[model samples]
Each structure stands twice: as structure tokens, then as C-alpha cells.
Target: MDLLVVGGGPVGLVVALRAADAGLTVTVLEPRHGPVDKACGEGLMPAARERLAQVGAAPNGHDLASIVYTDGRHRVSAPLTRPGLGVRRTVLHAALLEAADRAGVQVRHTRMIGIEPGDPRDHARPARVRTSDGQERTAPFVVAADGLHSPTRRALGLERPARLPRRFGLRAHYAVAPWSDAVEVHWSRNAEAYVTPVADDLVGVALLCRPPGRWDPTWRSFPELAWRLAGSEQTSAVRGAGPLRQRVRSMVRGRVLLVGDAAGYVDALTGEGLTLGTAQAFAAVDAVLAGSPAQYARRAPALGRRSTLLTRGLLAVSGQPAIRRLIVPAAARVPAVYRGAVHQLAGGH
Candidate 1:
């Protein structure tokens, strides 16, 4: 095959579809079947929606007009100049899978357990991958989109140690109508609860926080949100993912490249994870088609530079109680700056 994309998630499928469109044969390896779901904020920025549409993977979702941050006492909202989307992870995955099928991209129900880099002396040599079935496959270029805790990245020894306090994400869906058209982020002393409307009668709530010794029940942290959801039926079991920060040594090594969360991840504080990952997928395909895999390493980081900077800045403040408490108030006090920040978060100039 021309390309082997590890992980059949949205970003991986995106790589497959794009490569196939360019007349390159592509295959995707994912142990899980279609409609794979994950614990995510479920809010796609306006730019992300457009990118998915361009690739023919747009899915049905609730429209989001703005972002509102509240600490109960203080609240501020920034309108997205363009509308965003609140899509369930499963729904988004299904859309991407359908597009991949239409593009004639092969989907294999196998896991990639290991990778053997192609000859360093010959850039044209195909890289070999060992699947969980104990079979080996070769492809001219390999993309490791195997998520945050990527086995491919670990096997390659590219994992970097994280120095900050570990934080986790927990998500669940509630069977209740959305009260607002905006994505609401409710802040507490210990954690932040993200409420996004994914359907006419379903909203997803995701929590970003440190391990729960500082707060118990977790729901207690967001009193207002808990009250609002008190009588609502839970639509899905809670899903969690953590130590949110992932650092990587490099994105390129010979004919192999890492995209999406496998490349690196900061915090999802700003809800731009999908947008950033999509940008990496675009850069990866361009580099591969250009016959310059090394260019991806140079281009990937710049693609998410703006989002990373803002997310890191917010994460730092989130760790400091006094500063964190000032966030909503500050944003409220300076509407222009807050709006500019929101515009930048949406991939605007």
C-alpha cells in the first residue's frame, strides 16, 4: 500500500481519504470497529467543521453560536464569528468512516503492535509493520494516529516525560434539551465542566481535572451544573482519559510519521483538539505526497502553535486558584481582548 494509517479515528480516516483522493492507495488499521467513541469535549470549532466538510466527512450536530465561561459569580461569553458544531464522538467517527469507504480506502480490523523503520539509506523503501495477528505489512509511508497513549509512539521511544501535575478527562451524555446555543464551561476551584449540546435532546458533559482527592463526587464542584442535570437521564456511561498532556521527542523518523494525538497533545482546555489534529492530518498528507516526510516534522508544530499557546496559558492559570478565579471576571472586564482570543481559538486571523 502507499500509506498505512494506524488508528481509524477521525484524523486517521482523514489521512486515508485525502491520500486516496490523490491517487495513492491507503489502508487504515484499527482494532475497534466503526462508530468508535472517546471521552472528549465534543465541541468542534468553526474551522474544524469547515475542514471536515471539505473532506466530505461533515456529520449532523447541534449548532453552537458562542463560548461562555462562568465561575457562578462571574460569567463572560465570546461569540464565534462563525458557528461551530457539537457532535458526539461516535457520530463524528461514523461520518469519517463513511467518507473513507466512499474514497475506496481499505479498513482493516487489526492492531499495529510494532513498526520497523524503512532503510535509513533508502527513503523509497517501504516501512514494515507487525499487526496483532502476527502478520507483517509494508507501506511506503506510515502514519501513527493511534491516539494519546499511542503504542506505536512508545515502541519507537519517542515518548517525552511530562513535568506538570497530571489531569484527567471524564465525559457523559445527559438526555436533556440544551438550554443555550452556546458551549458552557463551568469553572470550580478544582475542575472545569464542559457542557455541549450534541443533539436536540442530548448534551454531553465533560470534566477536566486533577485526580479527585481535592474534590469528591466531582458533581459537587459544579453545583449549578449538577442542579441543572439532577433530574435528567444519563444516556451513556462515563468515559475517562488522562494525564492530558503528552509530549513527544519528534514527529518524523525515516519513512514513518506521527499525526493527531500520537504526535503530541497539550490540554483540551480550549476545545480545539479536533481542529488541531485535522490540521496535522493535512500537513502529514502534503508532506507524504511531496516525497518529503521530514517536512511534516517542521510543519506539524506550527499548525497548532496558536491553540497550544492559549491552552497552555489557561492550564497554568487553572492550576493557580487565585488566578483561575479571576479568569471569567477578567474576560468580562475586557470584552475586546476576550473576543480576539476566541477568534484566534476558532482559527481566525
Candidate 2:
């Protein structure tokens, strides 16, 4: 194969599609079935939506026009420079799978158990991988988009220890009608509730918190949200992911390039995961096409620097209860700053 993309999630599929569009044969390795779902704030920022369309994986969902920050008593709203989309993970995954099928990208239903990096100096040499079934595969270029806590990243010795306080995220869907065209982020003392409208009759609520014990995303924690969701039937089970941060030593090793969460991740506080992941996917293929996968290491960081800095800064301030109480008020007081940040997040930069 010309490219081996490990991890069949949206980002990995994107890498395959882009490479296939360039006339390179691509194979994706994934243990899970198609249309896989995960615990995530499923709101796609404007750039993410655009990139999905650009890559021929556009999925239908509710239109998202803005972000609203609230602390019950205080609220601040910022409009996205371009409208975004609030899509369910499975919906997004299915679209990508279809797009990959149309592009002739083959997907293997197995996990990568081992890898041997190719000679970085010889672009023609193939990197090899051992699958769970004891089969071996080789490709000139490999992109790992295996997500947070990626085994591929660990095996490659790219994982970095995160020193900050650990945080977690829990997401569930509710069979409730759309409330607004905005993604609502409700602030509380211990956690934040991110409510996104994914369909006319479905909404996704994700809670990000520094858990005190077990991972319980208690809705009562946010009285306002609880009241709003009272008696609403849940459409899906609660799903969770965390420490919410993954640091990486670098994005490339020999012919292997890491994309998506496998590359590294910050908190999902800003809802930039898909946007950054797709950008990295494109860059990974570009580097591979240039016959130097190492260029991806230099290119990927710039794609996520702004998001990393902003998420870390927000997490730092919000970790302190005293300052956390001021976040919504601060945004309400300085609308322009909040608006500019939203614009940046929406890729207006």
C-alpha cells in the first residue's frame, strides 16, 4: 500500500481520503466497526465543518451559529464568523466511512499490534506493522490517528507525561428539542456543562470536570441545566474520556506521522479537536507526498498552538475556584475579547 492509516476514526479516514484523492493507495486499520461513537463535545467549529466538506465527508446536523457562556446569573454570547455544525459522533463517522469507500480506501478490521519504522533517509523503504491476527503489512507512509492514550504513540515513544491536574469528560445524549442555535457552555464550581444541539429532537451534553471520585456526571451540579433537562429521556448512555490532556514529544518518527489525538491533545474546552485533527490529517498527507514525513512534525504544532495555549490558560484559571467564578462575568464584561476568541476558534484568525 502507499499509505497505512492506523485508526479508522474521522481523522484517520480523512488522511486516507486525502491520500487516495492524490492517487495513492491507502489502507486503514481499525478494530472497531464503522460509525463508531465516543464521548465528546460533538459541536464542530466552523473550520471543522468546512474541512469535512472539503474532504468529501460532510454530514448533516443542526446548524450552530454561536457560543454562549453562562453562570446562571451571568451570560455572554459570541457569534461564529461562519456557522458551525453540531453533529453526533456516529453520524460524522458514517459520513467519513462512506467517503472513504467511494475513494477506494480499504479498511481492515484489526488492530496494529506492533510496528517497525522504516529508514527515514530512504523514502522508498516501507514501514511494517504486525496486526492482531499475526498478519504483517507494509506501507511507505504511516499515519497514526488512534486517539488519546494511543497505544501506537506509546510504542513509538512519543508520549509525554502531563504535569497538570487531571480532568475528565463525560458525554450523553438527550431526546430533547433544540433550545437554541448556539452551543451553551454552563459554568459551575466543579464542572462545566457543554450543551450542543445535534438534531431537531436530540442534543448532546458533555460535562468536563476534575472528578472527586468516580466519573459521575451529575446533572444536578448545574441547576440551570438540570432544570432544563428535567424529565427528558436520555438517548444514549453516558460515555467518558480523560485526563483530558495528552502531551507528545513530537508528531513524527521515521516514516510515521501522528495525527489527531495520537499527535497530542489538550482539553476539549474549546471544541477544536476535529478542526485541528483534520488540519493535521491534511498536513500529514502533504508531508508524505513531499517524500519527507518528518516535515509533519514541524507543521502539526503550528496547527494546534493557539488551541493548546488557550485551553491550558482556561484550565489554569478555571482550576482556581476563586477565578473560575469570574469567567462568565469576565466574558460578559469584555464582549470584544470573547468575540475575538470565538472568531479565532472559528478559524477567522
Candidate 3:
């Protein structure tokens, strides 16, 4: 394989498909056989939609719309203006995997055990990978899109930063018409629930907060905003997602690169995780095909900074009851500010 990618998640699949399209022989190694169960809000920003279209991997039957934000007391709505899609993670992954297969990229249902740095002079000798099933795969470059707690990243001696203050997330889907064409992000102190309309009849809801030591206590602490929606209808059971925390630093190391949550992830507040992953996938693939690690290295900081800013901003707002009280009212009364903020939340910024 010209490149060995560890993790068959969305970022990994996108990397494989893009590289293959660029005429590179790519192999994706994933521990899971089929679609990995993803706990995400499952909304794609305009930029993400554009990237998918560029790669010819856009969803066929997905719903497209903007997002709406409310606080139960006050509400603001904005038309997407640009293209955005609300497709389930599984559906999105299936499309990417199909595209990878069509592009002649090999998919291996095996786990990567370790990665050792190789000699820079010899492309083949620079990176060596070991698989859990005793299979060894070697390539000029290795990609660690394995995710937030990446084993490949650990094996490469990459440093993991201290976990962020708040560390947990809960997400699920419901079968109901969205209150508006735009995604609805309702805010409350200590938490925020994002409701993204994936289809006319289905909405994706996710909550993020501090994790409790025990399972029962964790679910108990999660704030329930979906149930408070003005005219919400019952459709699906509530699902839980994560103890996801923000990662510090860049996502690149020598010939090994990280994309999506593997590199660094922000809270679900901004709804930019999927967009960031898709963008990084393109940048990484382009860098690999062009034989320039520098290109890939340059792309992470700006995106990472933005993610951090958004996450912190949301945390700040959600943490202070007074701030939420003041801001929510101001946002509702100020249409321009409200629209811009909602646009940013939709990952337009």
C-alpha cells in the first residue's frame, strides 16, 4: 500500500477515498468490520458539503437546511443560505466507504498495534505498522485517524495533554419535524443540547457536560432540553454519547498525521467536529499525495484555534447563569448578532 491508514471512521475513509482518487494506493485498517456506531449530532456545515461534492461523495437522499437556536424563552432563526446537510453518521460513512471501494482503496478489518518512525531517506523504511491479527503493513506514510484516544498516536510517542475541565457528551435521534429549517441549539447553565434536523421527520440531539464518576449519576446530571422543546414529538429513544474532552496541540508528527477527533476535538457546542474532520481529511490527503508534510502541518493550527475558541466560548456562556441570561436575551433582540452567531454554530465561520 502507498499509504496505510489506521481507523476506518469518517476521517479515515475520506482520506482513503481522496488519496485513491489522486492515484495513490491506500489501505484502511479498522478494528470494526462495518459502520462504526458514532455518537454525533450528524450535521454537516456548508464547507463539509462542498468538500463531499468535490470528492464526489455527497449523500444522495440527505436532508439539506440551515439551523435555529433558542432558549425556550427566546428564539432566533436563520436560513442556511449556503448548502448544509443533516445525514446520519452511519449513512455518511456508508457513502464514504462505497466511494473508497470504487476508488480501489483496500479496506481491512484489522486493528493497528503500533507504529515506529522510519528513516526519512527511505520512504518505505520510514513507517512500520503492526496489526493485532499478527499482520504487518508497511507504507511510506501512516495516518492516525483512529480517534481521540488513538493507540497509534500513543505508539508514535505523541503526547496526550491533560483532559479539559468538562468531559462528557450525550447524543440521540428523534423522529419529529424540526421546529425550524435550521438546527436548534438550546442553552442552559452547565449544558447545551443541539437539535439538528437530519430529515424532515428526524432530528439529532446531543448534550455535553461534566462526567459523573458512575453511569447512573452521569445520566442523572445530564440536562434535558429536548423534552422542553415547544412542539417536539416523541419518535426515538434518547441515546448517550461520550466523556469527550478537548485535545491540546497540533495533529501531525513526522510522516504520521491525525485527522478529526484523533488530532484534537472541541465540544459539540459549535457543531464543527464533522466539518473539521472532513476539512482535515482533504488537507492531509493533498499533503500526502504532494509529498509535503509541511502542507498538512500548516492546516491544523487555524482550525484548531477556531475549535478551541468556539468550545471555550460555549463553555463560558453555558457555565455562567448570568451570562446566559444576559446573552440569550440580547441575541434574541439583536437579529444580526443572532444570525451571525447561529451561522458560526452551523460551522459557516
Candidate 4:
């Protein structure tokens, strides 16, 4: 294989499909297969939706034109000038997997446990991979799409922990049909809930907050959201993910490169995690085909800066009550600026 991609999540499958499209052989390694689930906002930015279409991986989901942020008292709603979609994580994964298969990218069920960098003395030599089956494989280039807690990153000394306070997320799907055409982000003093319509009769709710101190059945903090989801039966079990901030030392080292959340992550506050990862997959494959893997380090992050900034900014405000109080009101006051910000974050800038 010309490329060995670790972690067959969205980004990994993306790299495989894109690389194969570029006429390069590719193999993806991931232990778990099928419709894998995770805690995610589950809303794709407009740019991401288009890119997936270009690569033949667009999945079926509800259309989302706008984003509405409400603190119960104050609210800011901005329509996307570009196209965006609300799709379940499993559905998205299945689409990408189908695309990869169609493109002839090999899918392996084994896991990559370790990597041995190519020697500098032999420029043509490929890196060696140790698999879960205790077999070794070699490839000219390797991509670490393993995700936020990437073992490949730590094994290569690329971990860089951020100073920001840790936050976690929990997600579940409700059987109720969506009541709104746009994604609704309900903000409160203690937590923020993201409501994304993934299907005609299924909406996914992901809750973000500091870990709970004690179990409480009542969601008194977010009365409006609780009321809407009150008696709706849950279609999926609650899935959690966190310590949402991940930092990295660099994206490229020797024959290995980090893509998607494996490269770095801030928060899902901006709902662009998969979008930026899709962009990175494009950059990484192009760099590999150009025989200049180092270029990806400089290019991929540039494609994601706007989303990263917005994510960090939102996290900061969400952590501070005073600023949190201002978000909706400020956006409401300057609708033009808020719309421009939304467009910019959508990669339309």
C-alpha cells in the first residue's frame, strides 16, 4: 500500500478514499467496524457537506440552514449562507466506508499497536507498523487518524495538553420529530445542549458540561430544552466523550502524519470538527501525492484556523458566566456581524 491509515473513523476513511482517487493505493486499519457511535454535535458545516459530495460520500440527513443559540432569555439565530446537514455519526461513517470501498481502499480489521520510523539514511525506505495480530506491515506514508486520545500521537511524542479546563459531552437520540429547521443550541449556566435533527423522526441531543458531581434526574438548569424533550423516548443509548481540548506538538514527523482530531482539537462548540477533518484529509493526500508530506503541516491547519478560533472563543465565553450572558444579546444586536461570523466559520470567508 502507498499509505497505511490508522483509525478508520471519518478522517481515516476520507484519506483512504481521497488517496485512492489520486491513484495511490491505500489501506485503513481499525479494530471496530460497522456503524460506530460517538458523542458528537452531529451537524456538518456547509463546506463539509459539499466536500463529501465531491468525494461521493454524502449521507442522507435533514437539511439545516441556520444555527440558533439561546440562553432561554436571550437568543441569536444566524442562517448559513452555505449548505449544512444534520446526520447521525453512524450514518456518516457508513457513507464514508462505502465510498472507501468503492474507491478500492483496503479495509483491515486489525489494529496498529506501534510504528517504527523510517531511517534517515535510506530515503526510499518505508515506516514499519506493528499490528494487533503481531504482524508487520510497511508503507511509504502513514496517517494517524486515531482521534483525540491517539495512541499513535503519544508513541511518537506528539502529545501537547492544553491549559484549558476540561469539559465533557454526552449524546443520545430522541424519537421525536424535529420541531425546527435549524439546529438549536440551548445554553444555560451549568451546561449547553446541542439539538441536531439527524432523521425525519430522530433528533440527536448532545450535552456539554463539566462532569456532574452527583446524579440528578431533573434538568432544572435548562428548563426549555428539558420541556421539549420531556416525554420523548430515546432511540439510542447515551454516549459520552471528553476533556474536549487536545493540543499537538506538530502534524508531521518522518514518514508519519497526523490528520483530523489526531492532529489537534479544541472543542465541538463550533460544530466543525468533521468539516476541518475533511479539509485535512484533502491536504494530507495532496501532500503525499506531491511527494512533500511536510507541506501538510503548514497547509492543513490553515484550512481549519477560523473554526478553531471560534471553538476556543466559544469555550472561553461558556466558561465565564458574564460573557455567556452577552453572546446571544450581542449577536442579536449586531445581526450583520453575527451572520458574517457564521459565514466565515463555515469556510465561506
Candidate 5:
């Protein structure tokens, strides 16, 4: 094979498809079968939509809109003229798998165990990968999209940069009429609740907070905000995701490369994780085809820097109670600043 891609998530699948389209023999190894489950905000930003189109996998038949931010009382809604499409993880995965198949990439459902990096024999013996099923495979170039906790990264001995003030995430879906077409992020002193309209009658809610496991008290703690969103039927079981932080570093080493959360992650506040991963997939394919791993290493950081910076800045502001109080009021006062922030968060900027 010309390339071996680890993790059959959207990012891995996109890389496989793009490489295959460019006439390289491609294979993808994933631990799970089709329709893999991922914990995410599931809001496809405008940048993600554009990259999907480039890969011939644009989200279709979905209601599209911008995003809205609120401090519980005052709200500012901005029209994301570029508009983002809302698709569940399963739906998006299925689309990418189909595209990958059509583009002639072979996908294997198997858990990866180890990799042989920098071995001269890696070119001839190829990189050896052991699967959970006791099967072994080899390919010259490997792209790891295995996610935040990646075995591939560990095997390569790459150190992940520290993210200050670790946080956790909780998420669930609701069956009810959407309050608006836009995604609503309601900010509080220590945490924020993100409400994204995924369809005409369904919305996804994700809550983020610092660790040591606070937030156990539900409605009692956030009475007003909870009361306002009461009565909506829960469509899916409530789930949690994270330990989110700023993971700043290069995503490539030797023939092994990282895309998506495996490379580096940003705070989920920006809701741009999936979008950034998809964009990196394209850049990874290009760098590999050009036979320049250094170029691949150089490219991933630039792609995620802006969004990561914005996320870090927001995290700092949200971390301080006094700053948040002053910032929210000032942001509410100047609607343009709020709107611009929303636009950038929606991946327009």
C-alpha cells in the first residue's frame, strides 16, 4: 500500500479518500466498525463544510444557520452568511465512508497495537501494525487520526504539550422545536452550556467545566437556565466528553502523522474541533503525496493556531469570575463585537 491511515474516523477517512483520489493506494485501519461513535458538539462549521465539499462529501438535506451567544439574560444572534450544516456523527461518518469507498480506499476494522518508526526497513518491511484480532499489516506511510488519547502517538514517543486548567464535558440530545436556527452558547461564571440546533426539532446540549467533578447538582444549581430549557424531551442518553485544553505542538514524526484530536486539541468552547480535523486531513494528504514529512509537520500547526488562540483566550476570560462579569457586559453592550465573535466561532472568519 502507498499509505496506511490509522483510525477510521472522519479525519482518517478524509485522508484516505483524498490520497486515493490522487492515485495512491490507500488503506485505513480502525478499531470499530462502520458508524463509529464520537463525543463531540457535532456542529459542522463553515470551514468544515467547505473542506467536505472539496472531498465530494458536502452535508446535504440539512437545515443550516449561524450561532448565537448569551449570558443567560441578554442574547446576541449573528447571521453566519457562510452558514454551517448540522449533522450527527453517525451521519457524517457514513458520508465519509461512502466517499472513501468510492475513491478506492480499503478500510479494515481492527484495533492498532504498535508501529515501527524511523526504521530503514519501514520502507521495505513497511510499518508493522498488530491488530486486536491477531492480524498484522504493513504500509509505508501511516496517518494517525486515532483521537486525543492515541496509541500511535505514544508508540512514536511524542510528548503532548500541557493544557492549563483541565476541564470535562457533558452532552445529550433533546427532542423539541429549536429555539433558533443558530447555536446558542449560554455562559456562566465557571462554566458554559452550548445548545446547537441539529435539525428542525432536535438540538444538542454540551456542558463544559473544570475538573474535580463539580456540576453534579443539576437544576438546583443552575435553576434559571435549567428552568428555561425544561420540558424538552431527552432524545439520547446524556454523555460526557473531555479533559479539554490547549494542546500546542507539531502533529507529525517520521512517516507517522497525526490528524484530528490526536495531533493537538483546542478547548471545545469554539466548537471547531471537527472542522479543524477535516482541514488537517487535506493538508496531510498533500504533504505525504509530495514526499515531504517536514512539510506535513510544518503545516498542521498553522492550520489550527488561530482557532487554538481564540479558544485559549476565551478559556482565560471564562476562568476568571471578575473578568467574565466585566467582559460579558461589555460584549453585550457592543453587539458588533459579540456578532464578530460568533461569526468567527461559526468558522466564517
Candidate 6:
């Protein structure tokens, strides 16, 4: 194959689809079948929505028109310049999988143990990967989209365990009519409740907190979020992910390119993972098509600069109780600042 993409998540499939559309042979390796689920906020920024359309993975989902920052008493909201999608992760994955198939990208069931850089003499040969069943495969190019806890990235010796105060996210679905078109972020002293309208009749609630058992209790820390979700029957089991941060040394080494969370990640405070991953996948594929894998290393991080800064800033504010108390109030005092940030985040530039 010209391109061998590891981890058939949305971003991985997107890489394969784009490469195949560009007339490159592509194959995706994933252990799971269709509609794989994960703990995600499930809100796509407008940029990610556009990329999904470009890749022909047009999945229908609830429309997100704005973002609301609130602390129950204080609230600030800004309309999106471009609309976004509040989609279930499984639903989005299924759509991307179908699109990958239509693009003639082969999907294989296997687990990648690790990646070994290809020989220096054969620049066209891809790094080798050992599978769970003791099978090895090599290709001209490889994009790792295996996610935050990626084994491929570990094997590449590009990761360092997070040393900062870490947090995790747990998500569950509630069967209820969406309260609003805006994604509501309910802030509290301990954790923040991310409420997203994933369907006409379903709202996905994801909690970002330091503690482990907080998710099972259902918004107990944030009374405002709890009240809104009160009496809404839970529709899905709780799923979780990460310390919410992964550090990487680089995006490219030899013929391998790290895309999506597999590349590196910051806190998910801004919900920009999907957007950044989609952009990186496209960038990686473009470099592969140009026969210059090193180009992706320079381009991928630039794409995430805005997102990283915003997320780190927000995480810092949220970590400080005094500053957290002022966030929504300050935003409300100056609506344009909030609006401008929202517009920029919605891909208005």
C-alpha cells in the first residue's frame, strides 16, 4: 500500500480516504468494527464539519449554533460564525467508515504492536509494524491516528508521560430533548460539565475532572448541570479517556507520520481535537502525495497553535478557583471578546 494508516478512527479513515481520492493505494488497520464508541464531547467545530463533507462522510447530527459559558449564576454566550455538528462519536465513526469504503480504502482487522523505522537506503519502504498475531507489514507511508494512548507513538520513542496535574473525561448519553442549540459548559469548583446536543432527542454529557468516580454520580458537583439533566434517563453506558495530555517529540520520523491525538494532545478544554486531527490528516496526506513526509512535521503543529494556546489558557483558568470565578462574568462584561473568540474557533479566521 502507498499509505498504511493505523487506528481506523475518524481521523485515520479520513487519511485513508483522502489518500485514496488522490489515487494512492491506502489501507486502514483497526481492531474494532463499525460504529466504535469513545468518551468524547462529540461536538465538531465548523472546520471539522467542512472537512467531513470534503471527505464525503456527511453524517446527520444535531446542529450547534453557539457556545455558552456559564457558572449557573453567571453566563456568556456567542453565536458561531459557521454552524457545527454535535454528533455521537459512534455515528460519526460509522459515517467515516462508510466513506472510506467508498473511496476504495482497504480496512483490515489487526492490532499494531509497534512501528520500526524503515531502512535508510529504501526511502519508499514504510516502517514495519508487528501485529497481535505475529504478522508484519510494510508500506511506503504510515499515518498513526491510534489516539492519545497510542502504542505506535510509544514505540517510536516520541512520548513522555504527563507530569503535570492531569484530568480525564467521562461521557454518557441522556435521552432528552436538547435544551438549546448551543454547547453549554457548566463550570464548577471541581469539574466542568460539557453538555452537548448530539441528537434531536439526545444530549451527551462529558465531565472533565481529576477524580475517578465523579462521572457515575452524574453531575453532582455542578448543581446547575444536574438540574438541567435531572429526570433525563441515561441512554448509554459511561465511557472514559485519558489524563487529557500527551507530549510528542515530532510529527514525522522517517516514513511515519503521527496524526490526530496519536501525534500529541493538550487538555480537551476547547473541544478542538477532531478539528485539529482532521486538519493534520489532510496535511499529512498532502505531504505523502508530494513525496515529502518531513513537510508534515513543520505544518501539523502550526495548524494546532491557536487551539493549543486557547486550551492551555482555559485549563489554567479552570485550575485556579479565583480566575474560574471571573471567567463567565468577565466574558459577559465584554461580549465582543467572547464573540470574537467564538468566531475564530468556529473557523472564521
Give the whole-model CA lDDT for all candidates, comma-separated.
0.88, 0.89, 0.72, 0.84, 0.76, 0.87
If both were scored by lDDT, which would come out higher, candidate 2 or candidate 4? 2
lDDT, candidate 6, 131-207, per-residue tens: 88688988877889999898888888889777578889989999999989999988888777889999999999998
lDDT of predicted model 6: 0.87
**Model 5 lDDT-worst window of ten:** 213-222
| Model 3 Cα lDDT, one tens digit per residue, 1-349 | 7788999988888888888888889999998976666777787888788788777687743455656666667776667658788887777888888788778888988888777756544665667888888977778887788886777767766655655575666666666766555666766555666777777677777776676622222333333453434355545555565547645355677778888877766577777887788888888888788776667888766765656786678676666777766666676688787677556655674
Q: Which candidate, 2 or 3, would have the higher lDDT against the true structure?
A: 2
lDDT of 2 by residue, 1-349 (tens): 7899999999999899999999899999999986998999999998888888887888989999999999999999999888899999999999999999998899999999999878879856679899997899998888999999898899999988997688888899999998899999998887888999999999999988876624343466678888888888987998989888899898888888999999888888988899899899999999999988768878889998887889889999998899999999999999999998888877775
Candidate 6 Cα errors over 4 Å, as ranges:
119-125, 216-218
Q: List the residue pairs that clash in candidate 3.
A: 66-182, 67-182, 67-183, 68-182, 68-183, 118-126, 169-242
**How would you encode candidate 1's per-residue C-alpha lDDT over 1-349 as one tens digit per residue?**
8899999999998888888888899999999976988999999999888889878888999999999989888888999888899999999999999998899999999998889868544856678899998899998889889999999889888999986787889899999999998899999888888999999999999988888623233377788887888888888988899788999999988788999889988887888888888888888999889877878888888988888898888888879988988988998899888888888888775
Q: Per-candidate RMSD vs. true structure?
A: 1.6, 1.3, 3.3, 1.7, 2.5, 1.5
Stretches > 4 Å off in candidate 5: 60-62, 119-126, 212-228, 246-249
The number of the candidate with the highest lDDT is 2
Model 4 C-alpha lDDT per residue in residues 231-336, reported as the tens digit of each score: 8888788788877888999988888889988998888777778878988988999888876777887897798887787778878777888887788788888888
Give the Cα error of residue 103 in candidate 2, in Å: 1.0
RMSD of 3: 3.3
Model 4, C-alpha of 75: deviation from truth (Å): 1.9
TM-score of each: 0.96, 0.97, 0.88, 0.95, 0.91, 0.96
Candidate 3 contains a number of clashing pairs equal to 7
Error of 4 at 335 (Å): 1.7
